[model samples]
Target: MYRKYFKRLIDIILSGMGLIVLSWLFLILIIAIKVTSPGPILFKQKRIGKDRQNFQIYKFRSMRIDTPDVPTHLLENPDQWITSIGKILRKSSLDELPQLINIFKGDMSIIGPRPALWSQNNLADERDKYGANTILPGLTGLAQISGRDELSILTKSKLDGKYVENITFLGDFKLFFGTFVSVLSADGVAEGANKKNSNEKK
Candidate 1:
């Protein structure tokens, strides 16, 4: 009942309130991005959402205008494309604040599997086997707090499947709060090209 109905209700209410309350911070970040980078303030990318639907996910632009559209892990040297303010935004997870708009618009939930990139065929295929793609994507979820950028696509998809298997108000509550702790400590964040390099080494 909660998953089919009340969860979305909570997403709407909380995301709406968040947009209003965080407007000031949004403006500040907008100015910061403008001052530091010469590109669009918001970076929109096609991501796989509910039932593998395509949707544009929004984030604060953290890379230079010329940065490639490929995933950061695919880049040979991602740090070269990241701006100074972008680094802080990525680490603090403030870059994802715009996703509240996604949540409000029903493209996402406050907690669910993080959306797969349109180009991430391997991850998408893995998730299909677990039925994780049947639900809306999220601003953060089990895979996010568990390892963020550190986990392999298979492991991440499995965790996402686990989350789908046990969607509940209490579970969402814990994941939501747990996200804060993960952000503060910058847990499991593998910066850009390093992630790729590490995997190659492994």
Candidate 2:
């Protein structure tokens, strides 16, 4: 019942509120990216969502316009493509603020497995085997708190599956609160794990 009904209601309310509350930051970053980068202020990339559906995920443009389409870890030199403002946006996680729109559109929840880029075939394949898309993807999740950019795709998908098995209003609330602390502490990067090549290429 929680998964089918009230969860959608909660997603609508919280995501709606978040969009309104974060509007100012959104506007500011939109302008900042325009001033700092040569590309569009917003970056839209196809991501795998619930039921293996494809949706375009929104994010602030943080890399150079001509940045190659490569896995972040495989970028020969990621730092080189990041604009000055992009660095700050990434560090503060403001780059993800745009995903609230994704929430409003029902492509994502406030909490679930971070959506996998469509290009991340290996991760998506693993998720398919585990039925990870039975639940909507999220801006953050158990794997995110456990190890954002640090954990392997397999490990992340496992955590995501765990969340799907036992989702609740209370659990989501707790994840929301924990996410605040995690982001504030700049815990996006995994600790004691290799930041690069976290996803093994299949």
Candidate 3:
């Protein structure tokens, strides 16, 4: 009942409420990005979503215009591509604010598996094995709270599959609350002790 009907209902209500509440921040990020970077304020990239559907995920542009469209965890020198403002935005995770629009549009949920970029292959095999494409991707999930950039795709996929097996209204609530704390602490910025290349294994 919840998955089929109530989940979407909750998504709509919460996403609408979030947009209304965060309107000022959204405007501020837009202006800040424009002032700091000479390019689009929003970054859009193809990501794998439910059933392997491709959608352009939106985020506040946190890198310089010249930065490659590379995943943060894979960057050889992640700091090199970040603008001065981008560093703070990325650290504070304020850059993810644009995903509220994704939630509003039904491209993402507030809670679920964090969507993976199409170029990522570290966990592609496991993602397929876990059947993670069966459901909508999310802005945050168990894997995100558990490790964010620190966890490999295989680890994340495992957590994602676990969430899919036991999704519930209460579970989402817990994951959402946990994500807030994780973001505040800026946890999962790097995986393990590696501090880099969490997206690809050696």
Candidate 4:
């Protein structure tokens, strides 16, 4: 009952409140990003959402307009494309704040697996096999706080499946708090994106 109803209700309420409360911060970052980088303020990319559907996940633009379509791990020099402000935004996870819109739009939730990149066929397939794709993607999740970019795609898929099996108000609370701690500590955020998944093409 909670998964089908209350969860989405919570998503809408919290995300709506969050946008209202964070509007000032959003404006500030908008100005900062524009001044520091010559490009759009929001970076939109296709990601696999619930049921293998595609949706545009949003982030504050942290890279150059001409940044390649590949994941950061695939980029030969991700840092070169990152702007001066992007560095701070990424380190602070401010780059992801815009995803509150995704949650509000019903494309994501406050807790679930991070949406897979559109090109992440292996990740999506693994999640689908485990039925993890049945749930909305999230702003943060168990795997995110546990290891973020450190864990392998398969490992992440397993953890994501586990989360689906164990979804509960308490579990979600734990993940939410854990994510807060992780963000504050900047834990598990692989800046160089060195982790490799088998599905990635060289």
Candidate 5:
């Protein structure tokens, strides 16, 4: 019941309210990104979603237009492509605020597995093995709170599987708020590369 109905209901209510309340912040980020970088304010890319569906995930642009379309985790020197403001946004995770729109659009939920990139075939295949790709992708999830950029892809996929098995109304709410707490403390964000790369995709 929760997965099929209540989840989307809550997502609509919360995401709609979030966008309304954060309208001012959205405008600020838009202008800030525009002035700091010479590119589109929003980054969009093909990400594998529920049931192996492909969708464009939206995020605030924090990289230069010339930045390569590769995961920051694999980049040799991600800092070179990041703008000054992008650094703060990446650390603070303000770079993800634009994803509220994705939640509202039904391409994502407030909490679930983070969408893997289409190029991340290995990760996607792992998710399939764990049955983690059977539901909508999310803005945050167990893997995100567990270790985020620090977790190995295999471990992250395992956590996503665990989250799927444990999905519930109350459980989702807890994880949703836990993500905010993680962000506040700047915990489990980065490992080898800058944390902002997670949202800088596309």
Candidate 6:
């Protein structure tokens, strides 16, 4: 009942209120990105969403205009592509604020599996095994709180599956609160490709 109905309701209410409450911050970020970089304020990229659907996920632009469209972890030198302001945005996760619009539009939830890049077939296939691909992706999720950029793809998918198996209001509440703590502490974040490569090699 919570997953099917009320979860989405809460997403709508919370996201809507968030957008309104955070509009000032958005305006500030918009100006910052413009002053520090030469690109659109928002970056749109294809991501695998609910039931494996392809959707354009929105983010505050954190990379240079010429940065490759591939994931930051795939970049040879992600720091070179990241602007000064972008570095702070990425580290603090302010770059993800635009996803509140995604939540409001029903493309995502406040808590669930983080969406995979559209090209991440291996991760998607792994998620299929746990039936985690059928639900709405989230701004943050169990995998994120567990280890963020530190977890291997297989492990992340497994945790995502676990989240799917136990969707409840209480669980969502904990994950949501955990997200704040995680952000404040900057926990488990990997700034470049090294962590992903190291985890894959392990």
C-alpha TM-scores of all predictions: 0.95, 0.91, 0.91, 0.94, 0.92, 0.95
Model 3 TM-score, 2 decimals: 0.91
Off by over 4 Å in 2: 188-194, 197-202
Give lDDT: candidate 4, residue 199: 23
- Each model's lDDT: 0.88, 0.79, 0.78, 0.86, 0.83, 0.87
Model 2 per-residue lDDT tens digits across residues 19-126:
898888888888888887677888888888888889988888888888777656676567787789988987787888888889988999988988887777888788
Q: Candidate 4: deviation at residue 41, Å?
A: 0.5
Q: CA RMSD for every model?
A: 3.1, 3.1, 3.0, 2.5, 2.3, 2.9
C-alpha-based local distance difference test score of model 1: 0.88
Q: What is the lDDT of residue 151 in candidate 6?
A: 84
lDDT of 3 at 31: 84
Model 6 pairs whose backbones collide:
none
For model 4, how does the per-residue alpha-carbon lDDT over 1-202 read when each residue is reduced to its tens digit?
8887888999999999999999999999999999987879998888899999999888999888888767777776678988999989888889999999999999999999998888888899999878899999999998888878888888999999999999888899899989989999988776444545422111
Candidate 3, residues 1-202: lDDT per residue as tens digits? Answer: 9888898889889989988999998888788888877888888888878887889888888787776555665566767677777778877888788888898899988888877777765555577778777888888889988988777567888888999888899999999899889999988776222465354111
Q: Ten residues in a row with the worst lDDT in model 6?
A: 193-202
RMSD of 3: 3.0
Count of steric clashes across candidates, in order: 0, 0, 1, 0, 0, 0
Q: What is the Å distance of residue 174 in model 1 from its true position?
A: 0.3
Q: After superposition, how far is residue 183 of candidate 1 from its true place, in Å?
A: 0.5
Runs with alpha carbons beyond 4 Å of true place in candidate 5: 191-202
Candidate 1 least-lDDT 10 residues: 193-202
Worst 10 residues of 4 by lDDT: 193-202
Which of the two, 5 or 6, has more TM-score?
6
- Over the stretch 53-145, how does candidate 1's per-residue lDDT look in tens digits? 999998998888887767787787788988999999988989999999999999999999988888777888999999999999999999888
Candidate 4 regions with alpha-carbon error over 4 angstroms: 197-202
